[model samples]
Target chain A: MTTQDTTYLDQLEAEAIHILREVAGQFEKPALLFSGGKDSITLVRLAEKAFRPGKFPFPLVHIDTGHNFPETISYRDKMIERLGEKLIVGYVQDSIDQGKVIEQTGKNASRNALQTVTLLDTIAANKFDACIGGARRDEEKARAKERIFSVRDEFGQWDPKRQRPELWNVYNGKIHKGENVRVFPISNWTELDVWNYIRREKIELPTIYFAHQRDVITRNGQLMAAADFLNIDEHDRIEHKNVRFRTVGDMTCTAAVESDAFLIDDIIEEIRSSKISERGARMDDKVSEAAMEDRKKGGYF
Target chain B: MDLLKFFTAGSVDDGKSTLIGRLLYDSESILADQLEALQQSNRKNDDGTIDLAILTDGLKAEREQGITIDVAYKYFQTDKRKFIIADTPGHIQYTRNMVTGASNSNLAIILVDARNGVVEQTIRHSFIVSLLELKHVVVCINKMDMVDYSEQTFNDIHKAYSEIATKLHLNEVTYIPVSALKGDNVVNVSGNMPWYTGKSLLDHLETIEVNEDEKSPQARMPVQWVIRPQTDELHDYRGYAGRVSSGSFHVNDKVTVLPSGVRSEISRIETFGQDQAEIHSGMSVTLHLKDNIDISRGDILVNSSHEPIVSQLIEADLCWMDTRPLDDSMMYLIQHNSKQTKCKIREILHKVNINTLDKIPADSFQLNDIGRIVIKTADPLAFDLYHENKQNGGAILIDSRTNLTVGALMFRASVE
Candidate 1:
C-alpha cells in the first residue's frame, strides 16, 4: 500500500483471495479442488492468504485419475502435509470398481472425461455445497464464457443460457437443496499470468513442470510421457527426450513439449514467445470443436 | 504491468467480437493451434481470411446462429498493460449482460457501424456506459472500409456522437475510425485515412489513462468474513476480512462499523505471509481492530468523517433482467457488496426510453427495461451514490422465491 504501484499479479491475487473468502463466507461445506497443478497450486497459496492463521474453512479435495504422474501425487501429499490441511482424494478407479462408472478402453481412451462422474459422486458423498476449481478462462473458448461462481444443478449440469448476471464483486451462492456451485477463483488469469505469478511467489511444483529426461512416445508431432497407465501401440515408438509439461493431466492425454525451462523464469520466457496455447498440447481437447463446451454441459470441470 | 478491464458493446453485426479478434490477432496474441482450428472450421470470408468473429463465439449454438449470446472474456498483454476484454453480446435483449460486463470494467469500446452511424443501439449502449460511470469511452467508428474510410463520414459521426456524449455527461470520449475486418487503423496506422493523424485504436488503448474508481476519496470495505485463528500461539487474533473497495486505510486510523455505529482503530493490516501498516483499494487484506466491535459479514467499515448515506428507503436506477418482469407485489433480496437484505419496491418513478433517453410514465416493467424506482430495504444500507462512488453504490435484486438475479440497481440517493 505504501508503494503507489500495484502490479497486475497483485490485482489478480487480491481478486482470487477475495473470491476464496466469499466461498467461505457463504457456503456451509465447501472444498478446494486441488489438482496440484500450477493453477491449483496458486489457488492453495491464495487460500492461505485468505484464511491462513485461521484454518481454511474447507478441506482440499482431489479427484485423482489414478493414472496421474507419481511426482504430482507425491507433491500434492507433501504440500497438503506442510499446510496441515485435510485432503480427501476420490479416485476414478474406485468409481469404476464400485460399478458407478465404466472404465474406458482403447489406446487413445483416457480417464479425463470420467473425472466428472467421480467428482459428482465425491461431492454427493461429502455433501459439499461448493467446489472451488482452478479453471482459467484463457485456457478454452467455453471456459471464457463460464462465471466465476458457476452454479450447477443436482445432476451437475451447467445451464449457460440461464446463467445469472455477475455484477461487481458481489457473488450470489444462493442455491436450493441438491444444488452446488463450481467456483473458479482464477477465471481471469491467463497462462502467462499464472507463470508470472508463480515466479513472483516462488511457489514449488512437481518436477514435471520443469525440464527433465523422460521416456516419451511421439504422437502427431507431440511427445506423450511414457507410463504404465498408457497402452503402447505397435505404431508408437518410445524415445528419451528432455521435455516438460505445459499442463499436467492424465498421462494418457497430456502431451509434453520439448524444452529446457528448469526455472520458473525460463518457463515464463518460453510461454511469452510460444505460439501454441497451453491446451493445444493436450490430446483431450482435440476430440471436437465444442468438446469442452459439451463436457461442461454434462458437468465436466 | 497494470491491468485494464474493458468491455466491447455495439449492435448486432457491428463487429464487437471481430474488433476483439482483430486486436488480439494484430497484436500477435493469437496462438498457432487456435488459428489452425479457425482455418479447419472452413468458415473463411470471401477474401479467404479466417472470420475472426468466430474466435469469440464459443458456444455451439452461438456458432451455429453466428451471434454472441453471452460475454466471452479474451486476454492479451502488451508491454504497456495486460488487458481483459469482455466481448459482450450486442443484441438489445442482452442489455443486462452488457450491464454485467460494464459493471466490472473501467473503460468501454462502443462500436458504431460506419454505414449506419449513430443508430438507436448506439444511444442505448452509450446510456448504459454513462449510467455505469465509466471514465474512458473509445467510440470506434468500425467498418470504415464500407464507407471508403472517408474523413467526411468520420467527422460527421464524431460530431453526432459528441452531442450524445454531452447529454450523457460521459467524460474522456475518444473517437477512432477503423475497419476491424480490413485491419485499417485497428492495430497499426492506416494509410486510408490520411486526414486523421491520431493514434490507432490499439495505440490509444495502450497509452490512454484509465482513471480508476479507486482514486475516489472515500474508503469502504464490506466485511466479508471474520478470521480468528483459535490457537494457543495466536489466541487474540480477530481480523475483518474484505477487499478495500476505494481509497486506503492505515494503521491507527479510526473507522466506524456501519449500522451498529461502533468505533475501532486499525491494529494491523495482514495479507498472505506479511503484515503491513496500510492497505489500498483493491487489496484483499485482513484488518485487526484494537477494540472487539460487533462486526459481521453484512457490516461495512467506513471512514467516520465522510460516511455514506445510511437509510432504509433508497432511490436507484433499476434495470429489470428477468423474463418474468418486475413484480412489485413481492419482496426481493437486495445484495450490496457483502450484505443481503429483504426489500420491496416502494414506487416506480418513470421508465427511460433507451432510444431517446426520455423519461416516460410506465407502471409495468419488462425484461431489459431501465427505470428509476424507490426501494425499501428491511435494514438501512450504508452506501454512496452510484455516480459518486460506484463500488459502494451498486446493488442487485434477487427474487426471494426464485432466487434469480432479477435486477441490477444503482443507487441514486435516499428516498425523501
Candidate 2:
C-alpha cells in the first residue's frame, strides 16, 4: 500500500487534472477560456500538469471586453508567452462595430453582456468542439445544477432543463457538428478552495487582486473602480481607498471590497471569514434575480 | 479538513430543502447577501419567515411549481469537514435525478416526515442507496414539532424503518428525530426531546469516520490521454496519463494493457513533471513504460497477475432516465470510464418494483425504472463488479440519436 495520504486539495487537483485530460482526449478542437481571474489561473496550472512536458492540446482563448483592467491584459499576455501557447482574443468592441450587438448607454452600462455575442461568434468561427472554463458550482445557485461537461446547442443556448446526466467520472463529450460542450474542470471547488490552491501552488495573479490604493467610487452600495471608461455621475464621490477585488471581470461591472489582504495567505484567511459570496460584489448579477442563469442560457461564459 | 459528499432524498413537503437550509444557516455558510435576498423576496412561508426552500430551488420554473425538479448541489463546511450536499428532488418522477446525485455520494440522508412514518418513498430511496452501495445512511425523522416531540412517535417510526432497512441491506442506518423549521437536532441538540440522546445531524457529519473500502488488490488505471511531446528535448516521451482507479502502482511494477493484453513494466511515475516513486488511487499521473506498445484511450493498465474480466457480454442493473421507454432493438453507446462502445440491450430479465421491492418481469423499461438487463457491446470491456470498485464498474448509456444520456448502468457480473 502506498503510504501517501491524499489531502483535500490534492484530491481536488487530481479530479481537475483528470477532467482536463478527458477534454484533451475527447474533443477534436478545444480551447481554454482565459479570463485572467484566479480560477482561470489555477486552471492554467492544472492544464500544465495535465499536458506539460508537452504543449497544451488546445490554445488559450479570451473574450476581450475592451473594458478590462490593463494589469489583467498584460498578465494574460505574459503568461501566454511564458507557456509558449497561442492566444485567441474575441473582441466585443469588434462585434459592436460590426453591428452584431448594440452598446448599452447608461451610468451602469457594461460590455459584460455583449461578450456573449462575440464569444458565440468566435466559437462558431473557430469550430471549437469544446471550450474549457473555470466555472465553479459553489459560486452561484444556478451554476450548482451544471454538469461538468455541459452541452450547448448550435445557437450556443444552454438548456438547464435538458442536461445530460453525468455519472461517476465518466464524461460524455459526444456532440454533433455545430454543437459544442463547455467543460468546467473545477466545478466542485469553492472560493476558499481556489484561494488555498493558489496559495499552495504559489501562483501569480495581477496586482489588482492584492490590496492597493485605487481611485474608487460608491454606487448602489458597491465599490467600483474609477476607470477611464467608467462614467461618473455628478453626485458620485471618488476616493482613493485600500481595497482588493474578490473577483475580476470587466472593469465596468466587477467590484472591490475593503481589505488589507496583501498576501495570498492573508487573502485565504480573509475569504475563510468572509460573509459575502464571491459573486455578491459583482454588479452585473445584481441586475435581476436570474441574471446569471439568463446569461448562461444565452451562452455567456 | 476532510470532505464528505452526501445526498438527501425525501418526498415533497418532507423538508429536504428546509433541512439543507438549516444546516447552511446554522453553520454560517449562508452569506449575508444571500440572507438579505431571501428576506426581501416575496416567497415567504406562511409564518412570514423567509422561504428556505427558495434558497436551493434556483430555477424560475422550480419556484413557480414549488417543488424541486432536478438535483442541486450545495456546499458548506464546519471546522472539521467540508460537505457537498446533493439536494435531489423527492418526486417519484425524478428518481433518475436521485440516482445521479447519489452516484458519487459517500453517504445518503433519507428524510422521513415524522407524521407520515415510513412511506413508500423512504423504502424506494433506501433501496436505491443500497443499490448504489452507499456506506452510511442517516434516516432523519423530521417535523418532530408537529408530532409534539413525542418519543413514542420516534420509536414507532424507527422500528418500522429498521425492518425496511434490513430488507434493503442497509445496515449502517442511523435514525434521528428533528424539526428542520424549528432547528431541532439538526445543528443543535433539541431541548424538547429529553428522552432522546444522540449527536446532532451536523455533529455526526462532522465527526463520522468515513471508512473507505480497502484499495482493491489489483491496480486499475484506464488511459485517459496519451501524452506524446514529440518535441526535440522530449522526443522519446510516450507517457500514458490517467487516474488510478484502484490500488496502487509503483516503479518497476509489471503491468499489462487490457483488451490487447500487451505486457510492460512501469519505468517511471510522473506527477506535475516530477518523478514519484508510486501513485495511488484517485491521483492522476503520467507513467512511462519500459517497452512501447500500441495503446490508446479506452485501454486500461493493470497489475499483470490481476487482469480484469474482458468480455463483450455483461449483466448490469440500469436506471432509465429518458422519457422514452428503453427499446431493446435500438443500439446505444455505452461509456464506461474512458471507453465508449456501441451496445444493444440483449434482454430485460426483471424489473424491481421500488415501492414493494418485488422483482417483476418486464419487456421494456420506462423512465425512472430500475431493472436488470443484459448488454452486448461491440468491443471488449475490462471492468470490475460495481460492488467491488465503483470507479471502474459504473457506466452510462447515451442515446445514439439524441446524444443524451438515457440511462446509468452498474455492472452486476460478466455473462458467459
C-alpha lDDT values of all predictions: 0.91, 0.91
> Which candidate wins on DockQ?
1
Candidate 2 wrong stretches, greater than 4 Å: A1-3
lDDT of 1 by residue, B197-234 (tens): 99998898889887565677788889999988889988
Residue-by-residue lDDT tens digits, candidate 2, B1-416:
76889999998899999999999988888998899888888887778887788889888788788889888998888879889999999989999999999997999999999999999889899989988889899999999999999999999999999999888788788999999999999999999999989999999898888846336787989999999889888889999999998888999999999989889999999998788898888889999899989899989999997888888999999999999999999999999988999999989999999999899999999999998999999999999899888888899999989888999999999997
Chain A only TM-scores, each candidate in turn = 0.98, 0.98
lDDT (Cα, tens digit) per residue for candidate 1, span A132-180: 9999999999999999999999999998898999999989889988999
**Candidate 2, A1-301: lDDT as tens digits:** 3448777888899999999999988899999999999999999999999998888999999999999999999999999989999999999999999999999998888898899999999999999999999999988878988999999999999999998888888899989899999999999999999988888898999999999999999989999999877888778899999999999999999999998989988898898788899999988888788888998998987
Task: Name the lDDT of candidate 1.
Answer: 0.91
TM per model? 0.99, 0.98
- DockQ of predictions, in order shown: 0.80, 0.69
Model 1 iRMS (Å) reads 1.2
- Range of the 10 consecutive residues with the lowest summed lDDT in candidate 2 chain B: B209-218
